[model samples]
Target: MITPSVSDPSPRRRSEKSRSATLSAALELCAENGYGKVTIEAIAARAGVSKKTIYRWWSTKGAILLDAVTELVASGSPLPDTGDIEADLRTHIGSLVRLFTSPVIGPAYTGILAELLHDERLARAVNDELVIPRVALVYQRMRGAQEQGQLPPDADLPLAVEMMYGPLYYRHALGRSYPDEQRIETLVAHVMRALRTPAPS
Candidate 1:
């Protein structure tokens, strides 16, 4: 009796292709119909894959969306890292504002924030996968500033992060208005001022 040879599929390549297709379809559907209206069936249809294929990898639509947004934000843009902390932060925040204001991203962001309000799991996933990495980058920059004596030794890094991000997120997610260049510049200046001032002795 002849025996068939055992062979394993290329897991890395297969997984990469699967992830790419899923993210592409998720972003497309999310942009077109908003996240609330997108279903696994719709994403699978757009991706030309079986629903089982998506479900095999992701447990929920939000999970798929989280991955999709992370990929989109990471791929299209490089986070700013100028040696000057204030300049770098202004560049970073400006890029963020442009991203949030884009026609392709605005609605998707709004949808994601809306879902996050109601879904703890999805919120956690988004925070872990996307927000934390970027936040860490900002923190690293702040630490570097402290080391360089650009910011006071006692600067509150976490509060500084919130100060930089709070206005941008609030304006975009709540007010539905994009931050203008002047607003971004002012934010950077204010944060820099706060960073420079020494904490009360």
Candidate 2:
């Protein structure tokens, strides 16, 4: 309604508006009424689109939520490349800790992750679409560190990345105690130690 819904003559413009509306509605509903209570019908109603319109793009409610999350994640801050791997990891991981605790996206994303457990198809798509791409970005940063002799050349980057995030993800996904600044700092310290990066001499 705000942006010339009276309406855009271009089909692409109409599609873009509809997509944005649907994604926004999904996030709003999830935040207002817990992810479990967010249904496709509710999203369609709130988005001002028919159920068929939603289904034409997404197979299920989870798929819609996944797309919503991917859009938000894509717009978020990228990993810092200040050239000090330890400092960079701390900054990046700190951002993630905040993301896990974020009120808007946290609950919705946690729900999608839980849904992934029962839906094998969604799981594969999430791994391929969301998780793997983010992981790859970190790996790219660590590879740079290897070239600079910050992390050892043979460092187990994948496992080390896991070590950085596994505990935090476990707590956040399970709705456990929060990962506050101190807790995140402690985690970063522990993982950096495991990397065996040389200290400034």
Best by lDDT: 2
Clashing pairs in 1: none
Name model 1 segments beyond 4 Å from true.
1-11
| Candidate lDDT values, in order | 0.80, 0.82
lDDT of 2 at 79: 82
For model 2, the run of ten residues with the poorest summed lDDT: 1-10
lDDT of 2 by residue, 143-201 (tens): 89889988787678898888877887788677797667777778878887877864455
Evaluate model 1: give its lDDT: 0.80
- 30-127, model 1: which lDDT tens digit per residue? 88887789899998888888888888889988888777777767665455656688888888888877777776766677778788988898899889
Candidate RMSDs in Å, in order, are: 3.5, 4.3
lDDT, model 2, position 20: 89
Question: What's the count of clashing pairs in each model shown?
Answer: 0, 0
What is the TM-score of each predicted model, taking all chains together?
Answer: 0.88, 0.89
Error of 2 at 2 (Å): 23
